[model samples]
Target: MTKQPAHIVVAGGGYVGLYTAHRLQRRLRRELGRGTVRITVISPEPYMTYQPFLPEAAAGSISPRHVVVPLRRVLAKCRFVPGAVTAVDTEGHTVSVRTVAGEEAGGEPLRIAYDELVLAPGSISRTLPVPGLAEHGIGFKTVEEAIGLRNHVLEQLDIASSTRDSAVRSAALTFVFVGGGYAGVEALAELEDMGRYACRYYHNIRPEEQKWMLVEATDRILPEVGEEMGRYAQRELRGRNIDIRLGTRLESCEDRTAVLSDGSRHPARTLVWTAGVKPHPVLAACGVPLDDRGRVRCTTTLRVEGVDHVWSAGDAAAVPDLTAPPADPPALCAPNAQHAVRQARRLADNIAAAVRGRPAADYRHRNAGSVASLGLHKGVARIYGRRLKGFPAWLLHRAYHLSRVPTFNRKARVLAEWTLAGLFRREIVSLGSLEHPRAEFELAAGSRRHPEDT
Candidate 1:
C-alpha cells in the first residue's frame, strides 16, 4: 500500500501566513519533490499587503500597486487558494472555506481535509456599538480602505471649495479620526498634510480652514513610542493646529454629527476609526483552546496547545513571550509585525523539525523597539534606550521598512517612488470614480439611471 502525502494548510496571508509558507517551501523541498508533502495557503486576497506603507500609499507618496506582493509570484513551490477559512474542525482535521466566487453566488462553502493546520487567520477592526458608526466610520487596515480614504478626503476638499452654504462647507472641511495608535496618527497626519497642501490650488479654501481632529480614549497617543516621545508627538501635532482630544470617547455619530463624551458635537463628514483590533472570529468556532482574549492558545514553539497536528501564531495566537522576566504571570508576545514576522520563521522551522522527527525549538526574540512616520519629513523612533525624532527619524522609518518589505522588486519600486516624490510636487487628484467605474457608462447607455434622475 502506498503512503498518502501529508497536506499542510495555512490560513491567513498576512505576515505570519506568507512568511511561514514561504520558508516551508525551502525547508520541505525534499518532501515536496518526492510527493510526500504538500502545502496550500488560503486567504481572502491573493496578495500579501505590506501594511507599513499604507499611509504613504494613501497620501500618494507611493503607488498603491507597489505595496502588495502577489502570492502566486512569490510562492511558486506552494499552492495558493484565494478564499477565507470560515470554520475549522480540529477533531476531523478539516477546514471549511468560502471562495470569493462561491460567496457572490451564495453557494455552500468547500471543505478540505489537512494533516497539519496553521491557524493564523489574523484579526479584525475592534468596533463599538455607537449609533451611526457602522454607516459613517472608515477602517484603515487594508490597502483598499487607505486608497478609498485618499479619494474621499480629496472629494471633501472639492465639496468645501465649491459649496456656498457655510454649514455644508464646515462639515466638508472637518475630518475626525478616532484612535491614537500608529494607524490613526500616521493616517491623520499624512492626509492632513495632503489636504493642506491641496488647499494651495483652491482659491476659496485656506489651509487653516480645514479642521483636523484626533480623539483618543486614553490620555496619551503613540504609547508604543514611550511617554516622552508620545508627548513630543502630541506637541508637534498641536503646533499644526490639530485638535487633540485626550481622554475623550465618541458617544454617537448619528446623522453625520460626531457627539463626544465631553458635551462637544461636531458635524463632520469623514470619521476614521482605528482604535484597535480583535482576534479573528474563526478561532472561536475552531474548537481549539483559546486564551481569555479570544486568541488561540499556543506553546512557545507555536504549536496549538492540547491539539495534535496543529500550529498557530501571529495576531490570532497567544504565545508566551519567553523574553519577559519570570513572574507570577508571564507576558505574551505582542500582536505586531515585529513579533509576527519572527514568530512565522520559528513556526516554519519547528514544523520542518517535526517532519524529520526532531525536537521543536521555542520561539524567542526581544522586541526591537518601534518607529513611526508622522508625515513627510517627520517621524519618531525609540530603539535600544535611544530616542530619535524629526527628520532623522523620518528617514530611518523609510529605510527600515523599505528594507523589510518583501521582494527586491517591491523594494526597488518603493524606493524609486520615494525618490521621484522628493523631486516633484505631490499628486492630489481625486479618482473617486474608480470606486464606481461603470456609473458614467451606465447613465449614457440608459440601462441604469442616475440616483439624481430617480
Candidate 2:
C-alpha cells in the first residue's frame, strides 16, 4: 500500500505565514519533490504587506505596490488559498475556510484536513467602546487605510482652500491622531510634513492654518525608544506646532467633533486610530491552548503547548522570551515585527526538525533596539544601548528597513523611487475618487434612465 503525503496548513499570510512557508520550501525541497510532504498557505490577501513601510507609503515616500509581496510568485512550491480560516478542529485535524467572495455572499465554508497545523493568524486593531468611534475613527493598520488617509488629508486641504465659511474651513483644517505609538507618531508626522509641503502650492491655505493634534493616554510617546528619546520626539513635534496632549484620551467624536477627556472639544474632519492590537479572535475557536490574553500558549521551541504536530508564533503566540532578564516575571516577547520575523524563521526550522525526528532548539535572541522615522530627514533610534536622533536616525531607519524588506526586486524598485524623488518634488495630488471609481458612471447612468424603465 502507498503511504499518503503529509500535509501542512499555514494560517495568515502576514510576516509569520510567509516567512514560515518560504523557509519550509527551502528546507524540505527533497520531501516536497518526492510527494512525501506538501504545504498550503491560507490568507484573505494574496500579498504579504511589509507593515513597517506603511507610514512611508501613506506619505508617498514609497509606492504602495512595492510594500507588498505577491504570495503566489514568492511561494511557488506551496498551494496558496485566498480565503480566511474560520475555525480549526484539532481532534479531526480539519480547518474550515471561507473564500473571500463566499464570506461576502454568506456562502458555505470549505474544510480541509491537515497533518500539521501552523497557527499564525496575527492580530487585529484593539479598539475601545468610545462613543462615535465606529463612525468617525479611521485606522492606520492596512495599505488601504494609509491610502485613504493620504487622499482624505489632501481633500481637506482643497476644501479649506476653496471654502469661505469660517466654521467649515476650521473643521477641514483640523487633523487629529489618537495613540502615540510608532504608527500614530510616524503617520501623523509624515502626513503633517506632506501637508506643510503641499501648502506652497495652495493660494489661500497656509501651513500654520492646519491644526495637527496628537493625543496619547500615556505620559510619554515612543516608549520603545527610551525616555530621553521620547522626550526629544515630544520637543521636535511641539516645535512643529503639533499639539501633544499627553495623559489625555478621546472621550467622544460626535458629529465630527472630537471631545477629549480633558474637557476640550474640537471640530476636526479627520481622526486616526492607532492605539494598539489584540491577538486575532479566530484563535478562540481554533481549539488550541491559549493564554488568558487570547494568545496561543507556545513552548520555547514554538510548538503549541500540550499539542503535538502543531506550531505557532508571531503576535498571536505567547512564546517565552528566553533572552529576557531572569528576574522578570512572565517574560513573554513583545508583539513587534522584529520578534515576529525572527520567530517565524525559528519556528520553520523547528518544524522541519520535528518532521525529520531531530531535536528542536529553543528560540532565544536579545532585543535589538528600535528605529522610527518622524518625517523626511527626521527620526529617533536606540540600538545596542546607543542613542540617535534627527537626520542620522532617519537615514538609519530607512537603511535598516530597506535591508529587511523581502526580495531584491522590491528593494531595487524602492531605491529607484527614492533616487527619482530626490531629483523631483514630492507628489501631493489627491486622488480621492479612486476610492469610488464608479460613482460618476453610476450617477450618469441613473440620470439617463427613465423612471418607468424598471
Error of model 1, residue 224, in angstroms: 0.7
Q: Which stretches of candidate 2 lie over 4 Å from their true place?
A: 101-107, 327-329, 450-454
Q: Quick one: how many clashes does candidate 2 have?
A: 0
- lDDT (Cα, tens digit) per residue for candidate 1, span 1-454: 9998889999889999999999999999999999999999998998999999999999999998998999999888888889999898988999999998888999999898998889999989999999999999999999999999999999999999888999999999999999999999999999988998999889999999999999999999999999999999999999999999999999999899999999999999999999999999988888899888899999989999999989999999999999888876778999999899999999999988888889999999967789998898999999877899999999989999998898899999999999999999999899989989999988889876679988
Tens digits of per-residue lDDT, candidate 2, 1-454, equal 9998989899999999999999999999999999999999999999999988898888898999998999999899999999999999988999999897787788789898999899999999999998999999999988999999999999999999988999999999999999999999999999999999999999899999999999999999999999999999999999999999999999999899999999999999999999999999999999998888899999999999988788999999999988777754558989999999999999999888877889999999878799999999999999999999999999999999999888898899999988887789999999899999999999998789676987
Worst 10 residues of 1 by lDDT: 441-450
For all predicted structures, in order, the TM-scores are 0.96, 0.97
The global C-alpha lDDT for each of the candidates, from Candidate 1 onward, is 0.93, 0.93
